[model samples]
Target: MRKKRRQRTILWCAIAAAIIIALLWTEQIALLYVLATLGLTILMLIVAFADLEGAKRSGQATDD
Candidate 1:
């Protein structure tokens, strides 16, 4: 359930980031705001495909 939530959050973030980027590019938004959001978008893309379950597997001593 938690993993699914994380995936959903990432998807929503990507969509929101795209919209924000579009608005920032077309509108006269502040440069700092654009850069901050772009940084967030890059961060979202970087960790979008990470596997939380896989990380747990490597740190555990038991399969069940």
Candidate 2:
């Protein structure tokens, strides 16, 4: 279901953030790349969730 997918997305994002922080703590320059990638991914997820919520609202309105 959509809820499950959303939860998984959030979980993965958290995991990614944790990994990036760990790498950063170790003074790894590679963490910069990971941070950039994760930032873009989080942004995309936000957009997708916004769109999904809008669609769900419209669908519910139509059903009434």
- Name model 2 segments beyond 4 Å from true: 31-64
Worst 10 residues of 2 by lDDT: 55-64
lDDT of 2 by residue, 23-48 (tens): 78988877688778888999999987
TM-score winner among the candidates?
A: 2
Q: What is residue 14's positional error in candidate 2, in angstroms?
A: 0.4
* Model 1: worst 10 consecutive residues (lDDT sum): 27-36
State how far residue 43 of model 1 sits from its true place (Å).
1.2
Model 1 quality (TM-score): 0.43
User: Over the stretch 9-59, how does candidate 1's per-residue lDDT look in tens digits?
Assistant: 999999978877887788857864877788899989879878878988898
List the RMSD of every prediction in angstroms. Answer: 7.9, 5.9
Whole-model lDDT, candidate 2? 0.84
